[model samples]
Target chain A: MAGRSVVDAGAPLRDRVAETQPSPASVIATEIKGLVARGDRDQARERFGALVAVLQRRALRVAFQYLRNPDDADEAVQDAFVKVFMHIEQYREDLSFDVWFMRILVNASLDRLKARNRQQRFIAPAPDDDERPVEQVPAAEASSERRLLARERWEQVTRAVANLPDRQRLVFTLSQVDQRTPAEIAAATGMSAATVRVHLFRALRKLRGVLGEQA
Target chain B: MNRREEPDPTLADALDAYRAAAWAEVDAHFDERALESQRQRILQKVAQAGQPARVLAFPGTTTSLRPAAGISRRWISAAAAAGLLVGLVTGQLLHVLPGDAWVHRVAPRAAQPYPSGRLTLIPAVATTDADNALLDAIDVAVTSRGASDLRAFDDLTFAYEPR
Candidate 1:
């Protein structure tokens, strides 16, 4: 069992995935499933609360990266949880619920994206509409030059990620933002492992292209 | 850790570092208060789900309280099926009963001449003038095909008749 350790960026990604410990959300999810089966939905919901607490921050982080809008991310997260609760009975206890839930979250975010797209089609956005930052990180300690450099890099990366096609963006967000393995991403997304790898490769290539151009 | 060869190790490392920094920045952006507020919202939604929701009554209201919107689509389908079955059985029962002479009056059944195994395509219930006109038009169209074809049509119809 891999202990809780910071991922080594220098190492290969698959090894880091292998070293990922079982998530606390998975264990609590199993307990919650049992409670639901026993006809104690109230208790099951209570347990579900704990699972959400464990996963929400990570969930929000992934959602925000994918959506780039805090309101959309917040709404998507809420929708995902409600759907999770409603479908708790269908959950297979043997699998990692965290991955299963991430699948649902990704789907929910996609749904919001489609809806926003539809709305945009019917009504053109105002000229003032901008990709607002979800939250501004205050760089109090960093030098002014360093802070400016970091901001420029952040903008470049964000624009590169946002320019990716929908499927590539989703694959990149899960693999890069959330640090999930290709195999795990395949399971979560109901895609073949090879397909996940191809997507990840294409996504990285695009990002690298963007970075190259910026350079 | 994956066996896939890194196309550009330097680029991979740069991306990884950038991802780590972004994660840290975003994680810090969301404070404890915001998360707790979200938590309370989730718990409140769950609590509301566990209880039976009531419809507010208005003056001179006739609509009854319905099950909460959170009810599954499966349950809604099951209820719809049950209602349909009840309607079908009740309709059959009403037909079986000797009462409801008024129903018979409104929906008078015309004795259909089956044409004795001939392909009789008469409208089952020619209640309207338009229906009768349509049936007449069909009769004219079929009769124009000649007697030999009519006999063949009857034979085809008999082939499809239930045993």
Candidate 2:
């Protein structure tokens, strides 16, 4: 009885529940289960391929954030997807599938990070070839000189954030860039709220000092 | 104790301005559609990969079960046939088979006598009879004394012939 629920591998259950009728994803998942039950490997493999295609982009982004290297990120994402497929019966429909999937991604990222740390391997950031100037606002009161200075200040802040200790850096990125709450960051990082707060405080102080010095 | 609650106007102004700036930056970065797409994709992968199915504690009605709902008569017939087959097979295998077949196939050691002169202490009184009162009393005494599986008196064969 445990680990048997109709879930669409093509889309999330939230979207399916929101639909007026049963979603195609649910139907597909049900069919996949039946195929699996009947020992129809070919059909399961085809469905699995479709599932991977649908999840690749989002998984890539999450992996990219954690691994900071495109190749490593891609590998991690693919591995996580494979793991999810292999252990599909462990999923619970009562919980949001995204949260569950993110849990997998986070765990995979942590494992990779730990392994790399053990090997003393440095993770390099992926190249952002599409980096462009901040879109300009016409009829703004601010002068071009002032805008340039602000942009420079932001750059300094970003650099300061990067230079923070790993814990501080992670807390700052999750809080500011990802807009996750302190509680959420605590949950993801497996740190106490007080610890997260301390990290945030240190990160902010370091950023202010760095940016203020640059100014 | 009621202390004077003096507002630090300078600190308040700085905090307000910082909050506004932070909000503006957050708003600039916000992408609802992107987040939704990510959520959808993650869910899809989870469902497809069967990750969600394993965590579910109970089997529920699926899309396939929905289609099967219309074939009531066929389902009844199939269920009856399956039940009959199982019942017949179980009865034949467990009870109707010959003793020799059971002894050879099921349990070869049924006729062998258990090793004698080793008394196992039963925790509670096993029977309600005046004749078994002695056994019950002995059981209580042995258990209370914490006597382990002690060997019975050697060279003495005691047999109880039931009436």
Candidate 3:
């Protein structure tokens, strides 16, 4: 159970949140909500920079894990942040803001993916640039032969993960990349806990098989 | 949600290494400077989204929208001048046509002393029987084409005039 707010009725909200489990990002979200509700949007925007700073790297990581393209990931993160600020009025303070935000980020990524699919039907895809980040990762490590082998394994794993069906990919990425639990994944994706667990098991089984094949 | 799923320690370790390796590459590429750039961009987008949309007052005629504002301006001025000239010509035609010519067309014959000192237009062929032949003649004359020349106007006779 993800209980967000524990009862501490004594201190002020901000003071109490300093040591609480609600993250700095969630606390910033709450403050921004108050600033927006009070019609102080300029101050809210000022506070929103802090929120973006707290969440930007994590958001980027989740997006890059999903998209594999840095540019698309950047765009997805930007769109999600803009949407969060635009619809800040609808946010509920009692629930976990991180979960709410991750849901928005996931939706934004899905929209970008759909748009890319439509665009690909008309334009012949270019040979993927040799300068891709995934291909460039293992070049910096110790032995030359070892680096080549490591690159091959990483490429194989990436391909295997990419080939998973959309739900499985989502479940696996949120679980593996974003470090979300089955319960959190259920909340973010609107799937039931049992469904999240089922998808998680299937994804893990397939990935393990891929690792076994490599071995 | 945060509880580590303890299904298999070896599998979890491998997956954790995988996750770590993936994020390490991310951190290598997207460094602090890159993250700051992204943060600034997100804040920029948020700021833009907060403001109300700018509405163009005259979308078509906006200077910014035009390919050649100077050329378009000259054309617009020329069009306005042409419109004004056409309007002036039409007004002049209307003014001149209704001058001495129209007065002669519908003017009364030398106002013979009306029974009262004031000018009066009396119906000529008064009838109690309700049929008005004179009115029928006037209607036909009014509806018929105007005389073809100025001489035609002079030849037009008013039946009510004294012979």
Number of the top TM-score candidate: 3
- The list of candidate 1 runs beyond 4 A from truth reads A1-22, A126-141, B1-10, B56-163
Best by DockQ: 3
Question: Which is the winner by TM-score between candidate 1 and candidate 3?
Answer: 3
Ranking, lDDT, top scorer first: 3, 1, 2
Model 2's CAPRI class?
Answer: incorrect
Model 3 TM: 0.65
DockQ for each model: 0.15, 0.02, 0.25
Q: Considering only chain A, what is the TM-score of each predicted structure?
A: 0.83, 0.55, 0.83
Candidate 1 per-residue lDDT, tens place, A1-215, comes to: 01111111122223323424556787787788789889998899888889889988888988888776778888888888877887777765556677778778887887888898888898977674333342332344167675555555566667778788877777778887788877667666666678888877887787778778877
Give the lDDT of residue A28 in candidate 3.
93
User: Residues A90-209, candidate 2, lDDT per residue (tens digit)?
Assistant: 554433344345546656766677777766656564475333244321123178775554445444554555478878866765565444555545545555557878887777667656
Query: Could you tell me the fnat of model 1?
Result: 0.22
lDDT score for candidate 2 against the true structure: 0.52
**Candidate 3: tens digits of C-alpha lDDT, residues A146-195:** 55655565666677788898998998889888988776677777777678
Q: What C-alpha RMSD separates each model from the true structure?
A: 20.9, 25.0, 13.5
User: How much lDDT does each candidate structure score?
Assistant: 0.70, 0.52, 0.73
Model 2 regions lying over 4 Å from their true place: A1-62, A114-151, B1-163
